[model samples]
Target: MLSMKVLFAHLGREHLGVEYLSAALKRQGHETALALDPGLFGINDNVFHNARLERRFDQTRRVLRALEEQRPDLAAFTVYTSTFPWALRMAREFKRRSPRTPIVFGGLHPTFEPERTLRCRDADFIIRGEGEGALCDLAHALEHGTDPREIPNLGFRADDDSPALNPLRPLIGNLDDLPFPDKGLFERDINFRDDYIVLCSRGCPHRCSYCCENALHRLHGPGWYRRRSAESVLLELEEMKARYRFREVMFNDPILLTHRGWLEELLEGYRRRIRVPFRCFGQPALMTDAMALLLKHSGCQCVEFGMQTVNEDLKRETLGRPETNEQALNAFRICDRHGLPFDIDHMFGLPGECAADHARALDFYKPLRRLNRIKTHQLVYFPGTAITAEAAE
Candidate 1:
């Protein structure tokens, strides 16, 4: 394939998605540059000529100027619902200045909701599902002048009415084949001096109605969950610990501690090789005494539970998460018994959630002392989740 330069624009939080794509592109001999938004980190004072917003505007101008100078063939964007407006705004501005450039949007927003995304004027193509390989395909196609219509996991604006969405690509079964994200690329805009983030796995296996993972997995076809080797994970941690000297590391995986054997091997490897106190995600049902002890021994300082609600009936009939309240409580108790700090998760503002449900949550929280933090996120209706249809009703 002909060599080409591609630039990635994103808002915040380590820039892992684009960094993986960057590594993939570089692995195939393409040039990649990251143009992260400084506005993402800026606070909003919520007033006219807000200094935070003004500073962000200035950063946007700098980005535009840099892109103009660099003149990359394609400007790929990692977008989310929160970052969509700004991503498109910058994309359109850059397109106005250099109309020949193609703008591709990826990530949770674009992946499941392609039609809504394509309606955005600047969204030229979307690489849905796991973008590492599909992004590489897009870059290669663009570099070699190949027809992009049939590229797997690609959605393109066509000449006719309906947008062209190619067949879904096969999911990456063994995630170890993918390159470790180039942390150096994101270190341009972030300093993880205290926090090291990792993704030892991809795709949560549960089909929680409100979660994007369900739709995302359907988009990937089947066998949605995949994990890297404990050795691979440990090696990456070893390097990051030595290089950044971070005080804490956090697993960004949706649900880690997938199984007893995998968790044991990882815990053993971590204890033997690395010890930078880390945190990870765990499901309430999967949380067990054995796993908690393994986590404690492995320097797992915290475990965040994704228990969307404490109401068992609502969870089963409405949320598609069937774990009992006792299951969740037992999970937390195991961690507490092991002296591992924990975070309890809950979702407020579901379709039928009421004052009683909230009071139930407060009552449930009263006895859970191991709780380092409690995260109560209001339900957001992303376009394609199973909860979306119910939410509309």
Candidate 2:
């Protein structure tokens, strides 16, 4: 098939999803470009803004200007719930400007709410889970003037203009088969210059109630967890080191220490091949003293644990987390003993939380030597999660 350009529009932060999709498209002999909005109102995904103040610094026209310049055959968006409104507005504007070119929406929002997302006339198609193969198929079908209605993991308008969705395909069994994410798309965007980001794995092992991972697990059925081999990851980092000259590596995995054997191999290879300081997420149950020591020896800068609430009862009953409060505290102690700087994720506004719970949390964290941060997040009920259904009742 002849080459066709696919343009991805994203806002608020550097989208790793976009980079991966670009790599997939480019691998298939298709062209790709990015129309990025700096998200000036809120820097680095900390989205906070006043409507009046935000109006003065709207970057829509600038983004649209880039879209017009690129003039891509297909325009795509990687939508999150937080960015859905902005993406919709952008899509509508693009439709007004160029009605013939089709627009496809993919990512978290559209994956869960495909029918609702298709209600918007501008979004011609939506891809549910693991979009690489599905999107490539869609592009090829569109380019070759074939039927895309039968493609797996695709949602689109039917003959009668009602929303139609296809069945999901199996998860990508081997992550190493795909090329490293095409970070070149963000070459002009300055937000993610210092840190080289990578995801060694996809899907979390635990089914936390509030997290979207559970929703994803339901969508893909079984065998959702997948990780790249240590060699595959290190090779990518070596390429990145030569290209970007980054200062630090950020492993953006939900739990990097899930598989001890895989992690040990990766850490050992990382220390030998790439000695850069890196940050990653850990689980309270998994953050043992031995693991902490291994991380410290391998140039780990900071490890973050999701200690959402200190109340073990609330954690087990409400959040579906298996780790106990004692385990969480022990994880902290182990990190402190090993001189490993760590961060704890704390959540407020849990179902049964009161002021006393906050006081208890403070007491729990009163004495810690190597505590790097206590990141706080308010409870949000994402669509189709176990927590969201429970909250509605």
Candidate 3:
């Protein structure tokens, strides 16, 4: 086996995807390092407007210097649309400074916009979908001068040719097969105070028109929702407890209660093993008094409901989320009854959503807001989502 030093560049906040990939690579016996751009941590309400581009540029420069000093055989980058421009800049700088090092880009942006990602002057290759397997394969191929063109699920830029497209790899079937992400990768820098994350499953069951996960399913194929067993998830929790001493585990699952049986098993496992407080994202339809009580007993301290809008017409026709206002209110009431702190996520500026609709949503949540847990944000279109195409139209 060829040995190579790898640097994975993440210009974002604490992301489990990157952490998982980094850990997998290290377990494969390759030298790996991570460089985080500070700007990603500073993102807030005014992120798009007040983002200090120059400061991000400087931070990228510092990271590049560190990469050059380490002289890795390959450099990989993960980027979102917001950070794509800066990540591209860092990749270009790395290529210019170390012409021999190969640069690969991945993440949601690149996965959805492979052609655009490949158009980057400095990007040598782009990995679509998951990065753990693809990145490891690319690293091995690069280190040994193997033909990366043969690798599946990758797009590469070459001289005198358009981007070379490789066949798509099948999505991993047994999620339990993969090892837990290397937590040590970000142990030195990650602040778990306000941000703790866990992924109980991938993909979602609901086809909410505005959601990125729904778009992903449409683009990739249906039945993409795969979940790890309760035992598998509990093992991860045990690892987190042993390693990070985390106070809370936040389930990043797109929807945590899609399967009631799975939710029951997971809650039972948490109650048995973790015995620590946890939180999760929820869809209003799944909320019930019994379910809330079970979750609370199983250490759930908080829940976030995707109560996108209260306008009946807008909720059903525009967003394709058929949840009723009464259902949402009942869910919140369940949370209240169980003493579980709950936050309602409301999105404004959706297509055809007028000021009246926004105000109606506010009014619907106004009584619930007395608990001071309602959070609202202007809708932002993510690529490959139905709303993205709708916005374009």
User: For all the candidates, what are their Cα RMSDs to the real structure?
Assistant: 2.9, 1.5, 2.3
Top-scoring candidate (lDDT) = 2
Which 10 residues in a row give candidate 3 its minimum summed lDDT? 40-49
Ranking by TM-score: 2, 3, 1
- lDDT values, one for every candidate: 0.81, 0.89, 0.79
Most TM-score-accurate candidate: 2
lDDT string, candidate 2, 90-160, tens digits: 99999889899889999999998899999887799999999999999989998998998899999999989
- Which residue ranges in model 3 land beyond 4 Å of their true spot? 40-58, 192-195, 369-372
What is candidate 3's TM-score against the reference?
A: 0.93
TM-score of candidate 1 relative to the true fold:
0.92
Q: TM-scores across all candidates?
A: 0.92, 0.97, 0.93
For candidate 1, the 10 contiguous residues with the lowest summed lDDT are 40-49
Candidate 1's C-alpha runs over 4 A off are 38-58
lDDT of 1: 0.81
